[model samples]
Target: MTASQDIISLSNPVLLEKVDKLRDLNIGQHVPLPQLVVVGDQSSGKSSLLESLTGIPFPQDQSLCTRYATQITSRRHNKDSVDVRIIPGPRALEEHRKHVEGFHRQVPSNLEFRKQFVDILKTANERMGIRADVSSGSGTVFSEDVLKIEICGPHEDYLTIIDVPGIFRTTTQGTTKNDIVMVKNLVKRYIKDRRTIILAVLPSNVDIATQEILELAEEFDKSGERTLGVLTKPDLVLEPSAQAAVCDLVQGKKRPLNLGYYLVRNRGPNSGLEGHSELDKIFRKHPWADLPRDRVGIVALKEQLKSLLVAITQREFPALLREIVSQIAECRREFNSLGSPRQDEREQRSFLCQIAGAFQERARAALTADYGADSVFDQDELRLITHVVNITDVFNADFHENAHSLNFEKLGRSEPSEEVEMLSDYDGVRKASSIISDLRTLIKKANVGVLWSKEFVELSEIVTLGNTPMPMPRDNFSEWINGIYLKSRGLDLGTFNANFIATAFAEQSRKWSEITKIYMRRIIVTIHRFIAAALRSVCSEEQVRTQVWEAILQHLVKCYKKAMDQVDVLVEVEHRKKPYTLNRQFAEARSKARGYRATEQLYPKARKDTKQFGETQYVVNLDDVAKVAEGKNNMEQLQEDIHDILHAYYSLAANRFIDNVFQLAVDYCLLHGPSSPLKVFTQDWVINLKAEQLERMVGETKATKKRRSGLAKKIADLENALKILVS
Candidate 1:
């Protein structure tokens, strides 16, 4: 080794050792692993070139023998020896998200020579469980695994170069289309590192344009800035002019790369330890006389590579550290996000507590529209959570003003009294006509009057039905009623039995009561239906991407599901809640429609008062109104009393129903249950999350622990390297 080379090597011991420590920890696979990489098309004599560089013989067979990426770290030493080690790929790291898997196994002892190198690979693949799972029996002939060979010799450069499996245009024996893709990807992973300088080898026999390695090198080092084009098998170009062209390419006759091409003649892989020196002899001196000695041999190539590696590494180390630190921040975020795997009941409980607590707080904030004024949620999310009150208001307006609905009582014909006239009680029948006359007079004076329509032949069939409550008149009833005066014929007034009139009214009254109750029950159902929907919107997944949601649900589904299932218990309570109060206007409207409760005896006080609500006056002459009930006792006014009491009661019931639904069913049962908001999961759900529900991954997986160890070691090594470089 030259004194200058030794000085360069010794000067940066920390940088080299730090890289070694990273390799030792197998941290490269997780990030862009930095190193010099060799890439070339199939059988481009890359093996021969490697042999010449390190003097290790490669098999000359046409078979794809160099299957994995082999890294050769050659340094000058007093005693010559080789040590091989296996470095695992990213597959073994659980945090590694890619689907690809790779192999890692080592040669147990010092490699004696080149023959054992190939043997070690074959043995490693079999030992590491590499074989074809497909029925074709093609076997696992190639892989992305790496084999590290550390060689020391007196003439070797203090350098590390990775030789990836050669890229092939077509598949040969026992290889599939997958083999081609795998090889390209394997080669790409190495050369894509910004720190690595690409060495693209091409055979002199093949036109340089035909080689794909040049394109691949350009993929990473686009301006040919870090790529050094190396030509191998220069002797294979038989024509003198062809040889001259090759020499011309080496001398920059064709468009020269920023890092120009070099030439080497690899006679054979089995060329002995003195192989590179033998190539340097140049037996046919005149054939190659035009070429520069520095651009034509392994000795010059090795020195050139050593100088390049030293200069580039020293120059690029700071940028490389910055990249590592940036990547470390990213990985640490991922590493922290994965958290820990929950392997035991205690760990699972703790893990669930952290997630559930976070979710519950967010959910509470979402439901109450209490996301702080500074909080920034999406428009859709804000609308959903904050504007639930809009739904409540709409629901309120719908049920309140619709008095003609089935939920309210009003006058309408159910069955004709002509049918009741068929009964043989003639005296009872004659009075029924007077009974109709009597009620008709009373309805006209009442403010809420829905009189029988013109279609009715008789007034007996008048029924007050659901939701169609009578409309209250705009004008005061007292003014119209006082205009009426009755003419007295002075005929003999007869006593009459009025039981039939009361019986008919009593029956219709019962029907109205039943219908109104049924309608209130339906209101309960409507309220809860919307509440259920609100529950789903509150508990559902949001836009954190597929992976975050999957991970959250994968761990929290049981807790969420358990809470949802128990929601019905709260809803049932809301459904059964009955209302007890009435709005003043609602009660007055109902009372005016059935005002027979203000009996004839109270007539003197009902004069000319524009009083409000239930106290409003409706005057009628006592003499004429009394005559409508001529000679009748128990059955005469009984139906009127029932109507007045029941209609008022229905208003109270309807108002009570509305309040209960919004306050209890929606607000309490869904948004704010007895203990907490509907968005909260029950304690039982978190406490009993199935042991199997979680992946036992509270940073708990073996792979994650291994990765953590690797990362910590990597950070430490990098910090050490930075310290030394700055120092």
Candidate 2:
């Protein structure tokens, strides 16, 4: 009787169940799964060993020796049963896969199961289009499809073994030269995986060095860690020398393996207790008995394989689980990128409607500054209202800095080499005066190259020059307004002309149009960027995103043009209309200016005194000052009043005009109202689209459909894989 220890199975049910679940899900196609693959040369007892292990009668005829690989799975169950199916290979076409999957059979595990099992194999071979003999060349010599056989019984050991086509050197009547190569390549494909434990079956009668399976195993597993040699048909070795060589090979004295070797006797078709007894009797004789008792016979080999499989499963399970989880995540991402299926007009329109609705919600949220905790609003570019407000603020600063005609603080001051002719209201002692008495002395001592032009330099540059001359001589504010005052003087004898004030105010605010237009352009660009990002987030299809963009782009262009037209009208009003204001500040400013004492001194005949030594002084003719003060225009008071009114009115108008640009041009035309471009994508707009337009916008390609299908299948497989590992 076989020792109890020799028949003990080390199979861990939990680990083997996980492996079986993954295998059934076909997860091995994506990631390598731990397996025990039986590979050997032709007639090397591979079929015999598989039959003994699985308790299934595999065909052993010379013509029917595993034309394609067979996956034999054995499980312990309450009753005896056999289930058979086909697992199509990677290279199988869709049509071929359907046909192969249709081949299924259930055989009763009774006395006649052997015959029924053989018939089932024959039927599977026919379904795969593998001919019984290739002499007539009607069918293929080999196939990538696999025959799956599942055996369940209370006494069966839980295991899975793949039996590939046996290696052959010569071409027979049923096999050709190409067939020989195909068989070797097929066998290599199975054993080459690092996760696979290679069971290299070798006949004891054959020379060990000449076996191709062992050489192939060594090629992939150089360290011999995963390769386990199985010396079969040990009873066939009759000679003492051949038997000694077989014993030496089994003991690892010759061509040593890391996993060592096992010796088993082929009991032909006998299995169960009868096969074990026959195998034990053959191993008891001569040199075979000298071999390790635990490394001989069918029972010991089965238990050893169970132990090795369980050990490798525990070793590689963590990494395999990680790979499975990684694959699941990647597959879901790709599947999502393809979006939901849209095969017909209804589905396509529904998909577009969903995108349009999402876009509208996001646009509203962005424009209203109602940013919830959504990550989409976290990006600065997507904050449309915030971006527009910032742009408005920058425009306000730029307008204040560059739009004014003069710097009001430096209005009454004279330039270098210039003198102000004024009628002084000074008392007995000297007061802080705006007059520079010696013009030529100051010009000579100045460091800058001063160009005393008859008029001012660029108004923008003049405003920037602090305490520096504006390249103009004499009183800059009075001089600037004197020209306009003279031209507009009519019946007003004591007061300055009102028309001149309007002209000055118009010139001061002229740059508003240009600055506002620049701000508008920035807002338009920000809107376009937001539209693009929102579209991409909602829908990934290029065709859909592009078509939707086109629909909205025309509207955006029109909105910008309308906004610019409105701005032009506003600027035109500021330049052409009369300077009139109900603002109390303007009236208060005029009254305040009239109440101040006259600072300007009219020195009609002022001569520089050369005899003053280091102090350059001017000698004033008091008699000529009286004559100049009595002139017609009263230009001194006229200039002072005009300066005050211009400063006050400009401040009031600047604030009003900036608010108008933001409300009428940006909010009404581009951002907020019904005509606004941001309202272009809505559910109503999607519903109103024509059938042809919807089709053009949402049509899907065949390749996209195929890719989506593939990814979906992958995700399903990987999800099943994850569940297997987790459970």
Q: Write the per-residue lDDT of candidate 2 for residues 1-727, one digit (tens) a residue.
A: 2222221232377678778778767777889889999999888998888877776667667556688888888888888888888988866778998999998888778345676877777788899998876676578878888888887888888888888988989988877899888888898888888899999999989999889888899899999999999988876789999998988988889999998899887656444546567667977777777888899988888999898888888778777877887888888888777766787878878888889888888897888888884787876667778767666655665566555666553323343788643222121113311222232233234211222341123112221223432221123556678778877788876696667777888767766766666666666666666777778777778877888887776666676677778888888888888988998876775554433322234422567677645776667676765554464457765776677778667777877788888898888987887888778888888888888888788877888877887788888888888776765
Residues 327-350, candidate 1: write the lDDT tens digits. 667766765665444557676567
lDDT of each: 0.54, 0.74
TM-score of each: 0.59, 0.71
* Residue 19 displacement (Å), model 1: 3.3
